[model samples]
Target: MSEIATSEAAHPAHLQHHFDSLQEQSQVASLGMWVFLVTEILFFGGMFTSYLVYRSTYPDAFAIASKHTVILIGAVNTAVLITSSLTMALAVFASSEGNRKSTVNFLTATWVLGFTFLVLKGIEYTIDFHEHLVPGAGFQMAGTNPGHAELFFSLYFIMTGIHALHMIIGLSVLLVILYMARRGDFSPEYHSPVEVMGLYWHFVDIIWIFLFPLLYLIDRHR
Candidate 1:
């Protein structure tokens, strides 16, 4: 019992006693994160399924409502998110290389880009509200299917609102990770947190990628 206890103590500070090795600890952490993300996927998947059903049922209304969306802002936000993903990926790479300075710099860039995306989204929402695009008693649309248009806007707000909430959570996590990086919490052998965060960031960005075209470019060629 003493030998076992001493052996555990001899391990690195980051390696928990429950984990036999650093590699094992990293694998466990990664598996846990993946499981959590899968649950998130199912949550988002239900919304997607609903969107498809409603769009198919009210194709014209959906298309017209989509046109009211601010395509320019949506496009710009997509670019910002894509850029942030790049920076996040670089941050993960830097952390795994034991380059603390580079990791902090990349993380900072990612956070800034993410903030820009949220700001643009806020402006877009403000424009929607001013234009009476929000689905409610004041919702206005000059079409035969105003009710259907309202439904489209309802889905729009629900889906994007949830996505924005996820972004807020992600930003909070990034802030903590950034502080940890500044304190030299990560090293080549122990960067699972960074890697796991990269997965989540990429997932959020991909969700937006799908949303941009669906909400802003529906039947635009018409």
Candidate 2:
């Protein structure tokens, strides 16, 4: 107990007054992030449930709409996000080791990969718009069930649009973290921010992992 108290007293920089020690602070931060992510999961869960319900109701239409999605771009974006997750992990690891240079480099790589994903998605969205997939007066899909197909596209846009927003936010946070790393703000003893942001980034990547097959690979064998 004396040793722990001494260590905590030594590192007053990042330790909050409310927390007894940096370890305690980091644990609380992780718990808070988990709680926040749970709410996020529930929020997304509603959309996923809606998707399942509607997809079951209109399998044929959903399949047809899925086919219209740009699978190549979707696949490439998946790869990009998956790679970004790796880079993010490396960034966290580097921060934990107090390797400032590696931390910055890895975070930059993750940011670049994330930006690439959004850019590819932008291109995909453009193609979708040109193809009249945007569910409106100009919407067009060659099928007997254009109404249901539009519904599929509607969900697709909402889910992915919100996801893209999250990605943008994550990128912004990454920039902040990168700046901090450049300033030597993180160290082996104090890198919780990097670690916590890594969790958020991974969660975002996992969402895409589920989304790719559901939105782009449905009935592709046909």
lDDT for model 2, please: 0.92
- Tell me how far the alpha carbon of residue 113 in candidate 1 is from the true structure, in angstroms, after superposition: 0.5
CA RMSD of each candidate after superposition: 2.5, 3.2
Q: Evaluate residue 44 in candidate 2 and report its C-alpha lDDT on the 0 to 100 scale.
A: 85
| Candidate 1 deviant stretches above 4 angstroms | 1-10
Poorest 10 consecutive residues by lDDT, candidate 1: 1-10
Clashes of each: 0, 0
lDDT of 2 at 123: 97
TM-score of 1: 0.95
Provide the lDDT at 13 for model 1.
68
The Cα local distance difference test for each model comes to 0.92, 0.92
| Residues 1-222 of candidate 2: C-alpha lDDT, one tens digit per residue | 223356755756777777888899998998999998999898888999999999999999898888999999999999999999999999999999999999999999999999999999999999999999999999988864899999999999999999999999999999999999999999988999999999999999988998898898867886
